[model samples]
Target: MITEFAPAKVNLSLRVGALGEDGYHPVDSIVVFADWGDALTVTPSDALSLEVSGPMSQAIPGGEDNLVLRAVRLLAQASGQDAKGNISLVKEIPAGAGLGGGSADAAAALRAFNRLWELDWPLDMLAGLGSQIGSDIAACVWSQPLRMTGRGERIRLIDDWPDFPALLVNPGVSVATGPVFAKFDEAPQTGAAFRPQGDLIGALQVATNDLTAPACAIAPVIDDVLAALAATKDPQLVRMSGSGATCFAIYPDEAARDAAAGAIRQVQPGWHVFPIVFRGVSAITPT
Candidate 1:
């Protein structure tokens, strides 16, 4: 059996631009993955199959539309090999919360199959296949701290990225990306023009998610989620990740992050609160 971890994706800094002629919004952001998320296992089988089971598994589809199947099928087509595996996915990330859960799962499948089939493909090739399926999957394929731009197709790995203690809270609500983007089209947030200051934390302080306001408009509860994070003690940075519903706060240390998580859980026991140290990876050239 082969096992893979699909970490939840987080956007530390997301800046979206006007909708382009291609009917896609241009985005510039720094993306990271948490230490916790879905877990997947694969075993060689006569035919390809999938089974999803987890706290949030009910929210995911188990049929052909599932990204895992789609990703693996694409890989097989590219490799001219049969896709044969009994795949199991234990989902932990909330669906439709803009955390790139589906994409992460698909990336996990690609990575797992790369080894399961002994393809020995490079990350770049896997990411190329991922990009054809989802905008976020390519970044998830890398699963490292990187700068993503051009509607999420372009990526440049950040070298010597620092792993920071952080808190992620979901208000037990799922906010779909379509509606959020629709609301954004109605009245887009003016993006702040800025550049990476070499100080990642500082760069993040100046950056913001353009989808925050629109997402708040779709789900008023999102405002509460952000407020809850802000009320925490000494959060160096507090903002929405991706579109909405899931917000995160960066703290100076793990101690601070854990305390904040405890306080939030005490107030809202129903909310999904996770304390994690965002993982970092060495730099690579832009792809």
Candidate 2:
């Protein structure tokens, strides 16, 4: 059996532009991964099968629609091999919260099959295959601090980013990405290029998510979550992640992040709140 980590992906900065000819919105964003995420285990099998467990597992689909199986089958067909496995996922990240949880799981499966099937394919090959299925898969496969643009396909490393201690809160609502992007007012042809300056943390202070407002418009609870995070003591930054529903607050220290989580949980008992460290990996971990 082989196991791989599918870390929660966070968009530290997301600036979306107008829709392209392909009907996808172009975006300029900075993405990172967290220590908190799902785990996928694969074992040789005659056919593809999957089982999902974990606090958030119930929210995921168990049928063919699940990306895990899709990724495995796609890799098998593309590589001209009959790759089959029993993939077990311990899902920790919330779906539809803009954390790229599903994409991360798919990427993990691709990495797992790359070894379990003895393909030994290069990282780029896996990434290319991943892109066909989801926009975030390539970035999640890399699992590092990336400056992502062109609908998330074009990626470059953003080095020396601080692993800011953060509090992620989801107000028990899922916002559809399509509608959120559709609601973007006067969407431009493309977002301006991002230029990093000064300290990474300080640079993030000015970075923004253009989808935040549109997401809040779809799910008003997002505003409440943002407000609650703002009330936390001395937070460095509080903002909505990805599109909607899930929001994050970066703090000066781990203590601050934990404190923020506790305070929010006390009031929003039903909401999902977690303290996480945003770590960046330089390469993929294949097992």
lDDT of 2: 0.85
What are the Cα lDDT values of the candidates? 0.89, 0.85
Query: lDDT by residue for model 2 over 206-267, one digit each (tens)?
Result: 87888887787789999999999999997888888898779998888998888889899899
For 242-261, candidate 1 gives per-residue lDDT tens digits of 98789999999999999999
TM-score of each: 0.96, 0.95
lDDT of 1 at 158: 76
Q: Which candidate ranks first by TM-score, i.e. highest?
A: 1
Candidate 2 global Cα RMSD: 1.7
Highest lDDT among the candidates is held by which one? 1
